[model samples]
Target chain A: MKAVGINGYGTIGKRVADAVSAQDDMKIVGVTKRTPNFEAKRAVELGYDIYMSAPDRENLFEEADIPVKGTINDLYDKVDVIVDCTPGGVGAKNMADYEKAGVKGIFQGGEKHDQIGRSFNSFSNFKESVGADFTRVVSCNTTGLCRTLNPIKELAGINKVRAVMVRRGADPGQVNKGPINSIVPNPPTVPSHHGPDVQTVMKGLKITTMAILVPTTLMHQHNLMVELDSSVSVDDVLDVLEKTPRVIPVEASSGLGSTAEIMEFAKDLGRPRGDLFEIAVWKESLNIVDNELFYMQAIHQESDVVPENVDAIRAMLEMETDPQKSIAKTNKNMGIIG
Target chain B: MKAVGINGYGTIGKRVADAVSAQDDMKIVGVTKRTPNFEAKRAVELGYDIYMSAPDRENLFEEADIPVKGTINDLYDKVDVIVDCTPGGVGAKNMADYEKAGVKGIFQGGEKHDQIGRSFNSFSNFKESVGADFTRVVSCNTTGLCRTLNPIKELAGINKVRAVMVRRGADPGQVNKGPINSIVPNPPTVPSHHGPDVQTVMKGLKITTMAILVPTTLMHQHNLMVELDSSVSVDDVLDVLEKTPRVIPVEASSGLGSTAEIMEFAKDLGRPRGDLFEIAVWKESLNIVDNELFYMQAIHQESDVVPENVDAIRAMLEMETDPQKSIAKTNKNMGIIG
Candidate 1:
């Protein structure tokens, strides 16, 4: 099994560790934390091969009730890949440490798109990340857009895309960051950074996005309108979307629910961490007037990038030429694919 | 039988004329027009008692081939109620003319909110206009909001309402107004008039509305997040909505379609003048995190308000009392309300 190491065992990191452990071809060799938090203590008690000392809590593992031992460098040496789940830009700035350790690394979505060698959404363009030394999992919005747009590109040649994204503010963990009662223009400027990021991933597609941040922690909803190169019906578009592996088309029959309901559905479906495809579409909202305009909603941001990190790790390991095929094989070996 | 006079022969007026003609208790006295338009000529040929000339074309009826002939004042005298399908503010200014002729009047939505004695939205508060002399129809956006809100109010008392109304620039007939590419803020300001108008008619419900106008002539889509007075589950909310009259709960299974599809569905259901209910909700979009927040999209204006005008006319004439009762009566009278 390819040994994997995770840095930053927070909510996302812990989930990533769990996802990696579930993969038959992968093993959680170690996880690093700067402090001995509840998650770190739990990871130690689970008997992981190594518990790398975070800079601040360098001696916590040795003082644990059931002592765990390892220096950060030794933990890095044992793993074939390390995932930096550090917050935002910290991952890119400190990526050199993982690179020098001779282990391939993955960066979180918080890092700028340019920081990583390749940016990826597992279902949209996983194959493109194969053999890359460092990959960045895109922010949730980009991941959601890729999942929605990839299917459209494959089936419908799009001429232009216009989107209005209603984004939720910081995750629950972040404190006092929003104008909770008002819908604020993110970046408080036209053509926000989130919009450009959408265009960057779907580089060939002519896409423009406008974002408004609402006070919510659950999920962002993208109201997308597209002008396709040719005429297509709503059924044709739904067919293409349904075929995309990672997207869960919010059905017409399902009564309306919140983002939490969507996430719950994702959990019940046995989706791996970061594999939540909560696309809630309003059928009446999709208008293909004549052959020119098509409307839809794509949801994404930080939380969605989790699965992309996992896919990037698999790609960097060079275990599968085709990422989907590799994932299928891995799942079969884990007895989860069937 | 009440003799109903149509003061304009535009799309709405013509439709109103047909609807009234079908009513057993209502008879078309005459239609007034500024020019000898095809609709006016058709109404004349159909053996109407008179064809009144608009102020500018008072002499046209004098030279008409058909026997039907009269001045605008003459037609006003014969009808018990006059339906003013004139453009915005025009009906308000001309209200005295109808009252002077001893006629009760129905004004279209374009009239200012306070100009007429009462504002009518058949299902929500038509009975309030039972004995009222003059009634103005509410705008389409307000009509859609009322329809959506009324059901929710019945289930859980709404303490506050926040809405983002995205409106289309112009209707299909207004094709001369092109360059429908940009999404412009409606009213280009906060505290939009549309919001307060809805609040006024909702019996002083605390509501704030923000609007964006796009370059499409289709229906408007409202992104509404309401704060209820009490907590309610999503299932309970859906159950309440599904049973609400005039508010058709569109399920995810119905698939996606445009405003036109919704209009077509209303038509197929034989909804009178297509004044039926429409609330296409994505179950995942609703969030009742606390006792407060609920998010949804209200139907845009055109398809919504136009039919509301028909209901307003019925309410003005005291043809029905309760909006649902009126809708049922009107539908049955029109051979559609089973």
Candidate 2:
């Protein structure tokens, strides 16, 4: 089995470890945490080899009655690849260590795209990251847009795409991150950083993105208006999207409507933390009038990129060069389609 | 006071009656219900003169311990005007009766635009129905599109307007309504009736629409993309929207993000039934990209037209010729903008 080590056992790290653990071709070697918090203990309970990021903090894990394997560097020596989920800027600093240790690393979106020469979004540009030592999994929102836009571009050809990204204020677990009573634009400017981030994975797509951070912590909703090169019916658009492995269509008849209902569906499906790892596309919302197609889809911030991370590993190691096969394996192993 | 009678005491009718009660120029003469349901009783409790649509069901109210004031014709004879709130197709049948009674009437979206010679939307084309005795208030989705589009049309002018209407399956109270688990297109056809409905009010606009009904009780979200006559600044678009009384800017800082939070905000504002009678525009989501202006806004289905109903009453009676003044009074009495 290809061994995968994840640094920073927080939201994304823990999820990536779980995803990698589910894969047949790969195994999770270890997960690193800076502090001996509840999540660290939870990681130990999941049977992951726990490594302390700071060697000085080894005693704290022991005091908390959580067993520790070694330091983060020690994990690099053992694993074939490392998925860096360290808080944003910290991943940039850790890149040098990853290079010196001679292990491939996958950085999360929080890190700058320039940190890794090639940015990865599983299906959109999986081939671009082939044989690359380091690849960054674009942010959850960017991944959603790329996954969505790429299909439309291939199937119908894009003329101009405009998307209004309604982002969540915080993750459900983030207690302190919010303006609680107000809608705040992350940056009080025109054309948010999201569109440029999409370019990192999907180049040559003329797209403009505007975002607003809302109070809900469930998922980020993206309202996309894609103008196609030629006219395509709503049926044709829905068929293409439905065939995409990671796009989960939210139906009206299942009695699930809101993001709240979707969360309940995930929990009922026995998913950990009720995380919806796929882009929940409102099936009914898919409509094309004239040459333009419009749909609204929700992206689960923490877990959407988890499956991408698994595929990114496959891409980096050349274990599965074909995106379709790799994504199929990841989606199947994670019980994505029930 | 001008006597205004509501011909159906359902979702839109009850709310319309409440709005009329709040206005100084008009009074709710009575409301009609086919059966003595709980809502009919609530209409009585709200002090509306309860008119029985089917005289045979008048005793049903007595059996339900509810009081009935008179038959439908009795209400027509007593009131100066009628607002038909019955379901679609039912209003078309009632139109002939309204004309025979020589009582001016207002019809809800369920009726065909041709059923009433003049189609009405409060601010958009209040003047168009200056002396027309009968007017039909457009559907909830059309109202939302008009509220957002009219301002843009006035400020920048539109080369083309495209919208995708993501409609709710049913009101929270409509338990039997919806596909429940399937995202079904309303007509299973391109260009839903909503686009033509908008034309009934604002004529000669190049527009197209598609719609899907999802399982949600709260509101309908309209994803709009407008190509303007000339490129305008993002601030300029926002300035125009902010100045419109019926268009509410949902701030990101107020911690109000989703329709759920906006509904809660309405509840906290002590609105009756927590109804937000204005369009909740995501201010932060508004952006102008290379002559294309994009934004996402939600219309609370139940009460949005209530304010329009109040405005329509003034327009029908020539009570307030200025839409700005009529809309202002409607907003003030309803506590729309504090």
Candidate 3:
């Protein structure tokens, strides 16, 4: 069994820590937080060792009566891999610490793709990450894109992909982020970074993406128009998507019409934190016009990548060399569905 | 001057009444309300005559100390045209009453296209509405689509159009309507009604639209991917959109990064109720990869159609035969700027 230490006890960090704990071949040795907030106290209650990210600010925890398992360096000493969930650029800054400690680092998508050298989505680049010392898990949106597009590309081949990503303005817990009552063309530019981000994982894919931020906190929705190499039936497209791991084909007929309903379904299914690790594709939205395939999918931003992080850890530690087997193990342990 | 009766003093109705009051060629003879709501009281304070839609419900208004200006029939008898602002489907139910009253009926987008026999977008079909007895102003989204696409079609000819409409979940005061925290694939079906609705105005235009409703009350944003008949420079495309009536090009650099800022900009500009009648297109989002043109535009759902309603009235009454002249008159009277 490999020991995993989660470096950041926030949204993605806390979830990854739980998922790693559930895996039979891996365990969360500890999780880190710079502040003695409610999440830090909750981590203590869950009996996970809490590591302080800021070595000099250890007193903040003592005053809040939240016990600490020494600083991040000490956690690194006990773990074989560190899953860094520190906000975006901060992960890049934390890279040196992981390097100095000689621990394999699994970074989140926020960091620059070049900084980590490899960008990963279990569905797209699992084999490429095996036995690597470090790899970055792409953001929720990109991971979602790769999971669906890579499968379709393998099935009928793709000439090009044009997607419009309607992203949520903020996560439920993120009170500061906004577009609060507006829809913003996030970068207000063509192929807004996401298309190029997807290229980081699935190389040589012809894709262009444009995104807008909406005043929603539930999930990001992507409307994809893929120009296939040849004509394909809607059933054939749906077949590939339904068979793909970590993708659930939700139909409007099932009353799972929107992201809200999907999230509610997750809660009903007893998923932790009402999280949906799978991408929910609207089966009713699948359509074919000659060579073009259009469909819509919802990405639960906070949890979709949590399972990806678990798979990345296994790949980096070489515990699971086969991509499919690793993905299966991660899914089974986390209770992820098709 | 045409005397206009605004039937249904709700969200669209109240705004249309105010807009009509501002126009020199039109005046709101009266507005109808079913009950003595706050809006009804506000309508009275505005010094406009208030008509009771439910004549039997007049006692409800009398008990609330609000005076009624006879029944809807009384207002219709005095008006040359009636701008039906009733909710969707509700307007269709009132069509027979309009026919009996012998008043030219101008319906909101909520009603069916066949019910009114013609759909009007001043920029797209004002001339077609001239001397007509009835014309339905397309919904805010359809009006917005026609304004931009028609201009572009005239400029470079559109081969096809694909749009993803990220719609607002509820109007500002519609606390009852929702997916309050979710992003919904409105119909969760390919080519949502919007595409067919647009076809009602810009006939023979190849287009497909998919809409997702998000938790917001400010505006609806459209991400349009238009395949042009031939290559066009970004400047040329921008020129066409910039010169279009009822369309304003906004940039992120100006801090109008999202709909919230745009709404705030409207408030700052002294627009009543902070409503944006013009579609705010993100100038920086305008880009062309060969013949495929991509851009994002925001439609203030509450008011974008207000000016369209005004123009439809002028057309049906033959107050202006030239579409351009009517559009200019409507824009100037309502302070609409590109």
- Identify the leading candidate in terms of lDDT: 3
| lDDT per residue (tens digit) for residues B1-338 in model 3 | 78999999999999999889989988988999998989999999999899898768877988999998899988888999989888899888888888888988989898889887999888777888898888889999998899899989998999999999988898989989986778888878888989999998898999989888888888888999999997779999888878888888988899998888899899998999998999899999898986899999899999999988888888889888998887888889888876
Which model scores highest in DockQ? 3
DockQ of each candidate's interface versus the true one? 0.02, 0.10, 0.78
Worst 10 residues of 3 chain B by lDDT: B179-188
Span of 10 residues, lowest total lDDT, candidate 1 chain A: A181-190
Chain B TM-score of candidate 3 stands at 0.98
The CA lDDT of each predicted structure is 0.64, 0.82, 0.89
lDDT-superior candidate, 1 or 3: 3
- CA shift of B141, model 1, Å: 6.9
TM-scores for chain A over all candidates: 0.86, 0.97, 0.98
Q: What TM-score does the first chain of candidate 3 have?
A: 0.98
Model 3 chain A: ten consecutive residues of lowest lDDT? A178-187
- TM-score for each candidate, following the candidate numbering: 0.52, 0.79, 0.96
